[model samples]
Target: MSTDFTDARLLDALGTLASTAGAAIMAHYGGASSIKSDGSPVTAADHAAEQVILAGLAGLLPEVPVLAEEAAAAGRWPASTRMLVAVDPLDGTREFISQNGEFTVNIGLIADGRPVAGVVFAPALSRLWLGAGSKAEAMELPPGAPISAATRRRTIRTRPLPAGGPVALVSRSHPDAATSAYYAGRGIGEQRPVGSSLKYTLIAEGEADVSARFASITEWDIAAAHAVLAAAGGEMTQPDGAPLVYGRAERQFRTDHFIACSGAYAAAGRR
Candidate 1:
């Protein structure tokens, strides 16, 4: 917890690392491979991108520990956290390998087991989203190279959900038949096929109405976006309507599916 590393400073650093990581990922795009604990493909890009972000985070916040995706998958989790950085340095590696370019770099800071700040960067698309808990602004910055990212910052916010016919952004990569059925069950109109954590960001910006994830997912996948979505006037919650929570025991991470929707939806539902 370096007081010197404010949310703005961390996001700026995250932007720089994301650019470097994205570039590293590009080099190994379709040709990368590493074995996961379960023998799934980890990819060279995952390690390369993670290492770059991890080192940068360490340098920027010398007292903090990072619980990055690549590192956690490798059995390197952090302990005793007043502040923790969650990094999905290359989300959507499968999409990246398939060349769909829907991947992103996710960074989140948790205090007392809840996110206080976060950043998500989609490199190939050259887009970035970040938030500073309650004290600073949440924003979106367009794509730029790593070396030139420090100067670019743009503010962003969610518009109200439409009067009707709200758009639904679903998982382009992981939608199961049941998930599709769930959306259909909700009478959702105008579905957009998206990948990675971009689903929540879209909801935060009011481009989409809700996200119903009926399948399994990890905390690292959604926590960062959860922070931004909350700041942008949205909620990520379990289907039972429980508020989304993080930093539970390890088993909970894999089972934490959630739905994200506009602030109005909850109030409307209650009526």
Candidate 2:
């Protein structure tokens, strides 16, 4: 693994690549989607965006391999490496198909099972979030604005839980009983339904306090936002309280039931 994987300039380039992929995705949004053999939905936008991200990452970091959602689904997975990039060109395909405008393009760098840097771009929302080293920030891209052009850039951090209770974010399409049960007696102030990795950004930016998922999820689905949350002083861990680790062969990139929480939630959990 390269020691410079978390370099700010490199992460910025990755962010731009994510934005480019997001543009490609928006071109095909709300059209139609096809079912992959694995029973997941796919569209031209997924392929086109993955191609753009793959090419851009190859040019920027030839030494690292990319494990992208569409490519992996097609059996194009590369050999496991300690350092690689995880790309979810268009996350929340169902949301896209339903025209909810909640999908996003994600690009993440993982080193030794830990995410080091990442970018998440919601093209329809004209928003972008990035994490590099110890810094996490968000930007508001104007309508038709280039990726490099943002009307505002702001540093983001997780806030302490309120005295009343913490707010929880749940998957809009895959809400499971387990998630609700987990917070049933914990006194969660509110539960919001959100799509894609944006849930992590919500917590990282302190818009929400925590997210718990009992359903299966892949590394690509959460790695990018995981980096952003971690940079913003949050954490993601299995229900048993172990930190979620990526690049696992036995599990095949599938994560177990886990919780992504702000510092406040994490501290409370330990009590």
Candidate 3:
């Protein structure tokens, strides 16, 4: 078994595992959803996908502890946090319930409170993005496609802020007045309301420039794509410019509001 999370073979396997979870999610998609104890919408898809991912991870990296969204929600968490796997089997449940193509399955490897490797797969769109160390890439993998099918992938990197100005990305379902004011204050007129971790992948791929949230979010919600963005030469930091850390079991893995920006935007102190 490969203990190196950044190994290309491991990354490929992780991507395949996520795609399998995506298939599970699609099986339950469009079906009725129920409210979790936290009042968040959940469907069979969420549980189904989580099962697939957890089982796969146990075989792939048995030594690493997994902190998964559904498990954490049930007050189950790994005792150790030194090295952890953050999993959000189905991110954007709302988008998933709404039947949009923006939902994703995320798996991130966190060590020393920093995400070192991660994969984000959007089954509906047949797109997958991954990152490790200082490298990131994206490819198309249909619902049941194997990792071997990811033969045509593009290496992705963040670009400098466009001359026209940074293109901002916001949540499609969680709009707020504070975010509106933040954009307006920066004279950011070009904004796209994206769903799930797609916003981070966009910034990592140079299709977008920045994204900010004024509300606290759970770690699994962003860790995977955060790794991708970081690997692609971007950064995800608190609004105060501090690095965002993960594996906060005490805080229930909740994170403060963060601003994600391309490398150039962060370099220019625009974050």
Tens-digit per-residue lDDT, 138-165, candidate 3: 9999876788887569899999778888
Error of 2 at 73 (Å): 0.9
TM-score of 2: 0.95
Q: Tell me the lDDT of candidate 1.
A: 0.70
- Winner on TM-score between 1 and 2 is 2
* Candidate 2: worst-modelled 10 consecutive residues by lDDT: 142-151
Q: Per-prediction TM-score, please?
A: 0.86, 0.95, 0.97
Flag regions of model 1 displaced more than 4 Å: 1-6, 134-153
Model 2 Cα lDDT, one tens digit per residue, 1-271 = 2348778777767777887888888888777788999888899989999999899887898878788898888777758658878889999998888888888889988999888888999888989999967789999863334556876788999999988789998899898888888889778998889999999998999999999998889889999999999999998888878888888756768877788999888988731
lDDT of each: 0.70, 0.85, 0.91
Position 149, candidate 2: lDDT: 82
Q: In model 1, what is the error at residue 1, expressed in angstroms?
A: 7.8
Better of 2 and 3 by TM-score: 3
* lDDT, residue 120, model 3: 97
